[model samples]
Structure formats: structure tokens, C-alpha cells
Target: MKVQKFIASNMIEAMKKIRQELGENAVILNSKQISTARMFGLLKKKQIEVIAAVEPQPKMKDVRVKEKRKPLSRTEKKPNVRNQSLTSSVYPADEKELNNQIEELKDMVQKLSEHSSPDEYKYYPIPVQTFLDHLRKQGINGMIMGEINAKLLNDWRSENREKTEQEVYQSGFQHLKELLAGVEYGGSQFQKKFINLVGPTGVGKTTTLAKMAAQAVLEKRKKIAFITTDTYRIAAIEQLKTYSSILNVPVEVVYKREDFQKAIKKFTDYDLVFIDTAGRNYRELQYIEELKKVIDFSQDIETFLTLSLTMKEGDLADIIQSFDDIKVDQFIFTKLDETATYGSMINLIFRNRIGVAYVTDGQDVPDDIQKASAETIVKRLLKGLGV
Candidate 1:
């Protein structure tokens, strides 16, 4: 028998290596996941390790019997049992070892199948499985789900006792809070002179902008003004004008870089100026360039990339990439009430490392918006899970 070990980044590659070395008759003895240290042990990467073995083929002469025994008649005496034993004694050790190896492999495969089966989560405690099901229903990404699963499993094992559903849910909530600890949160600080909202078409940028402006006027008591470059849609301009009229603030319409500069000069005395850019197919580089031509990005502006929670995560990621050249200070996720899946919001914040300023649930100016915090976001994600 021949035996060898192989390791690769994943199971598929490890299987390939084993097949190349051990051929089709090879048997997989065992397989496991491992982590390899990298960069002086500061980092670790996950890898797969597999063990395989194959028996060597016998020579032609050995495979051919030296003599053939004739069948004995029922009446004739049977061959002595000792003769039978002697015929099998040539490779007794090899046969015994192979049987032992096969038994061990069978045990390992049984365990692996039990752990990886479609109903595998059944092995976990009921409370843990319930929480995991909630995460899946929320559409959480696999990476984050893996981390959460590890944390929950570790806690469950450490306790060595079944925990209540609420206890397990709290554990998951705390883990999520820890993951978001390093990120910044809360709404605008009103420190910058210019507040800019940018995003693709029909993402509620205008309403969100109006909400923030209304908050400034009603709560912060700051002298705010609106500078709109959304000339492509006359209704957008009228919408801002409507909000400005209600808030009793001035609105400026700028069409060119010069107009933007002039508007900035006009609003220099105000406490803050909120600029609303046109909603175009930002996926096109030309639209982004046109935005550059119409807005003075060099000014003291804190840009907020507004996104709707109803959009798919891939589209949100692409919109974020389009604004890579622009300095986006934070995000303002709109229409939170429109979608039940909030995992994409958490995914985006974790991926981009950009914090969320506010999440709006309704179109009511300033009333439906709330400043985001790590606790609030996590609570919202874990809401109704235990029930």
C-alpha cells in the first residue's frame, strides 16, 4: 500500500493533487480544514488538508495462481483448515493494515457527512439554529455569517449547556456590534460649509437631501440654503424650492462651474449650504465628469453618497465604485422601510469602511430620518429574531 498527504487552498484543489499522485483507485483516508500562518504569523489563511492511499498492484506471476485445485466431492473429505490459512499468510500484515485503514477512513467519512449534510444545522442547539435561520432569512452575506456562526458556536460550547433563545440572540447581537465598533456613525456634525448628496437616478437623493436640510433648520437652528444642479429634471428643482419655501430658506440653481462658485459666494454668510446633484446614470464616466464640471468639489463640501436599500447589493457596490474618485465622507441610506433585507446595508458599510449618517424610512421631510449608530443598526438587523 502507498499513502501520501496533500494540502491546497480548497478541497477541490486538494482532490486534484491526490488524484494526480494516487490515481483513480486511491481512497481518501481523511480530510480537514486548516489555517496557515502568513506575514510572520500576523495573518492566517484557511486551507484544506487531505490524506489518501492506494494499494500497489501485484506482478503478473503473483496474480496468476501457481496451481489450480479441483473441486472436492461432497462425500470426499474437505481440505484441512490449516491449508486455507497457509494460502492467505503471505501478506497477513498488509491485509490487516489495509482493513484497519479502511475502517478509520469509514469513521472519518461518516463524521464529515453528518457535519456537512443539508440538515447539518440540526446538530447545533435549537436556539443557535434558530438564530442562524434568521440570519439566512435576512440575506446576510456568507463571510459575515461564518464569523457570526463561529462566535455563537464558541459561546455555546464554552457554556457546555443549552441556552435560551434570547440568550443566543443577544450573543449574536453583541457579535454584530463588535464587528461595527471601528466604524464611524451618527448624522452630519454641521462642521463643513457645504453638504453635497450624490447618487444614481431615483434613489431618493432629493427627498433625503430635503430631510437633512429640514433637520438642520428645525433641530440645529442653522441658517441653511440649497444649491441644486439637478437641472436635468425641472421637478427636482421645484421639489427643493417647495422644501425651501417651507423651511423659509433660499434655493440657488447653478448650471455651470461659474454658477456653482457664484452660489457658493452667495451662501458664504449662511451656516451651511446643501448641494443636490443631478441623478444620472452614474455608471457612465461621462455623467460623473459632467457632475465634476457643474459642482465645485474643491469647496469645503462633505459628500454623502445616497443609496436606496431596495436596490441589489451588486448595484450598490458598483455605484460606490463609480464614486471612488470622489471623496465621499459618509453614506445616507434611504427607503429603509421599503425593504425587509437590511444585510446589504451592513455589508456595504463593512466593505467600504464608510459609516452611515442617516437611514430614512419615509418621505416625510425630517420626520422619518434617524441618525444611525452601531447599536441601532444591529438592533434593527436582529429585530423580531427571537419571536
Candidate 2:
């Protein structure tokens, strides 16, 4: 390896010098900033420092190099050519030792996975289990494939139609359905109540409100009024307004305490009042508490906690813990289009007794959200598809 040090006024200059001297196959090992001072001179700006290396051969292209004066002899003599080398050969270990270390790593991974939160396991169940038995039964790749399928099968079972059936998708689907049995909304039973949407940022509350509103208006023919408290986002009010405009529905924006009271009062004749909330970070319970204070006395309000399917499973508990102060009667999920993996929706649903009411996919108004049925949710979840 050709190791060298390059200094410049800034990062781009330093990187240019490294590449120009070391050629395209350069690796950055470290970086630091050092001040330049002269004995007589007062001071100079801090110089950008870089440590770089070039492999034996020219292994990369499309590289930007700095201008460094080369020795006249270098123009006559060709640059030495050799195979590219990295840190790979610096600490070569015995094959047996490598195997033992690998085994140890696999064990550690499996143990970490076992102690993983229900949410942790939800997102990476198969991959976590696969690392443990990689050498025992099949190659690592084979282990990965098998474990992933097993995980998918289990997820599908949660949403399956029949609980007893052994079919892969059916079983996973069934499991999901059973997990959501608690908060399942039996339509028309409480058609005359207020449903609230609350969750961390970017979980699609406004869109969900439109979905429920559309269902109530078009399908149930129930008089629906949309209410929103999300006035933070620069275009938040406009987004909800857009949804309302397309749906041919009325939307009420409530900023102060009085506005909220008035909206609820205005919607008294409506069958359903779908309330959209701002997505906040779960860690900020103060805002949540403030929100609770804002809407605490609302009559017959059923609050739903919305979460993103793309979030890692481990964060779910943190989310629940943060939102605990606020009353969550049910849960809603949005951004299903962003996730390829279905994590612990079942675990959360079952453990929290929160049934999913709607799922929002895209940004399309009144089109992205859907009523989550046990059968459909199960079928898609088993396929490892986001619903």
C-alpha cells in the first residue's frame, strides 16, 4: 500500500491532493484539523488534514485528483503496477480461528435476537434466527432464505382467516387478525361518535381522516365532519384543505381551545367527526399532554394512535410509552408503501388491545387509506406485503 499525508485549506482540496498523488485506488484512513502557526506570524486559519493511501494498482476511475509537482524522473519511469490490497491481508487469521470467531459471532447475534424486544424481533425475526444455524444445516445464504420465509409465514398466519389452518399465508393472516380482535370496529354500532387520529410525525393522519370521511359519506351515507389540529407544518392546513376539497367534504381547523369547542359544536348534527392530529415525536410527551388538555372533555371521542409501518420494531415500545399519557382507543397505520417488511403489528395489536381501523398508503387524497379487515390484512401480511 502507498500511504501518504495530504494537507489543504479545505476538505475538497485535501481530497484532491490525496487522489492526485495516490491515484484512483485511494482509501481514507483518518482525518483531522490542525492549526498553522509561525514563530513570528500571529496565526493562520486551521489547515485541513487528510491521511490517504493508494493500492498497488490503479483499481478505480472517475477520480478527482489534485495537482502535485511530480519528480522529473517519474515522467520517464512508469508507475509501478501491482495488485490492489486493502487491510484484508494485514491481520490474516487461521482458518480454524476464523471459524471459531464466526461461530461466536453467530451465537452472540442469536442471543441478542432472543432478548430482543417483541418490536425488535418483529422487523428482523428471520435474519436474527438465521445467523445462529448457518453452519449447522446449510450455507449462510440458505439459512437467510429459510429464516425469512419462516418469518413471513408466521406473519401471514397472524392475518389468516382460520386460526387452525396450517397453510403458510393463511396461518400468518389468521394470527394478525386474532391480534387485532380487541379494537375491531363493528360498523354502525357507534356511528354517532368522535374518532381521533394521533401519532408521531409523518404517519399520515390527515390522509386517514379523509379515508374515514369518504367511507362515512359515500358508503355509509353518514354525515361526516373533518376537524384538524395540525397547524404546524407550513402547508399542513392546505393539505387537509386539499383533501376536503376533493372529497366534497367540510373541514374545520381548530387552533385555540375555543375553536375546538366550536367545531365539535358545529359538527353536532354530523354522524361522525374525524379529527386529524399533528404527527409528533413520541419522546415529546409534553406536546401530547398539551393535546390531551386541548381535547380532553370532548364528548365520546375514540382516539387512534397512528404509526408508520417503516419504523423499526424496537421503537414501538418507546412510542407506546410516550403516548401512554394520551388515551389511545385504537391504532392506525400509515405509509405502508414505504415498508417491504411487516414487523410486530400483531404483537402491538394483541398486547395493547388496539385494533387497526385504517391503513394509508400513498399521498393521494381519499384514495390511500383503507379499512383494515382481518381477512385482507392477513392475506397481504403473509405475502410480506405492506397493507
* Leading candidate by TM-score: 1
Tens digits of per-residue lDDT for model 2, 1-387: 567888865554565677678775565655666678866668655665777655453223312132243475845965433542532323234534654654565455445456333321222334332222321122213333334444443443345243322343343344446545556743223443787878888777767777677767787788777888887885878987887787677888887778888998887888888888877786667886768766744578777788888886668768887877666766777787887554456556656766677777897755777767656555545553222
Give the Cα error of residue 216 in candidate 2, in Å.
1.3
Lowest lDDT 10-residue stretch of candidate 2: 131-140
> Which candidate number maximizes lDDT?
1
Worst 10 residues of 1 by lDDT: 114-123
Give candidate 2 misplaced runs (Cα > 4 Å): 1-190, 384-387
lDDT of 2 at 57: 39
The Cα local distance difference test for each model comes to 0.82, 0.61
lDDT of 1 by residue, 1-387 (tens): 788999876544566687789886676776666779999999987666778788676564564464355699989997666766643544446666876776777577556445332232433566777787777777778778778877887687566467888999999999988877787799999999999999999999989999999889888999999999999999999999999999999999999999998988888899999999999888888898999999878888899999998998898898899898999988888888998888888888888899989989998877889999988888888877833
